[model samples]
Target: MTYGEFWVHYLRAHQRTGTRALHYTGSVLALALVAAAAISGDWWLLPAAVVVGYGLAWIGHFAVEGNRPATFGHPVWSLVSDYRMLLLWLTGRLGPHLVRAAEER
Candidate 1:
């Protein structure tokens, strides 16, 4: 699927507010972890960041949403979409995207 198609599927998979919140939490924590790793010179936190971030996201997918992750199909796009979703959310621009995605479903 193209990136646009995957985005629609991605948003559909993350329809629940709980799932999105978990993703937001994970995304923030991951960013903080990377920052900590850089500032502390402890490279271990890098991998830990990946685990922590994706782990929370996975937990949301399995425990909360009961769905497979879009990551399994499109890792690179999924990664970019995660951060893009976060930024759009931060800027109050996510609702329209979500609405559009919902319409597509």
Candidate 2:
């Protein structure tokens, strides 16, 4: 599917507010961990960050969303979409995107 199409699918997979909240938490923590790893010169924190990030997101998918993560099929797209969703959310623009995704459904 096209990038635009995948975005809708991505949003649909993250419809629940709690699911997205977990994702946003994971994303923020992951970035902080990465920064810590860089500033401290402890590269091992990089892997830990990945684990923390994906771990929380996986929990959301399985326990909260009751669905598989988009990462399994489209890793690159999923990663990019994760940040896109986060930025839109930070700017309070995510509501429109969510509405658009729901409309497509």
Candidate 3:
């Protein structure tokens, strides 16, 4: 799917508050790992970021959303959308996206 289309579906998949929280937590942890890697010169933290971030997100998709992750088909776009979603959430602009997704559903 195109980025726009995928974004809509991604928002829908993350409708649950718990799922969003988990994603936010995971994204933050990923960022922290990257920073730690840079500071400590431990390159392993880079892979850890991917694992921790995607691991939490997948858990939300499976246990909370009961759906497959968008990453399955669009890995790059899914990663981009994950940061976009996290940014929106951090800026308190996610409600409108969620509303739009729900309307489409």
lDDT value for model 3: 0.91
Instruction: Please tell me which predicted candidate would have the highest TM-score against the true structure.
Output: 2
1-105, model 1: which lDDT tens digit per residue?
788898899999998888989899999999999999999999999999999889999999998999998889888898898999999999999999999998886
What's the TM-score of each model vs. the native?
Answer: 0.96, 0.98, 0.95
Cα RMSD for candidates in order: 0.8, 0.5, 0.9
Please list all clashing residue pairs in model 3, or write none if there are none.
none
Worst lDDT window (10 residues) for model 3? 1-10
lDDT of 1: 0.92
Stretches of candidate 2 exceeding 4 Å from the true structure = none
The candidate, 2 or 3, that scores higher on TM-score is 2
For candidate 1, which ten residues in a row score worst on lDDT? 1-10
Off by over 4 Å in 1: none
TM-score of 3: 0.95
Backbone clash count for every predicted candidate, in the order shown: 0, 0, 0
lDDT per residue, candidate 2, 1-105, as tens digits? 999999999999999999999999999999999999999999999999999999999999999999999999999999999999999999999999999999998
Question: On a 0 to 100 scale, what is the lDDT of residue 17 in model 3?
Answer: 86
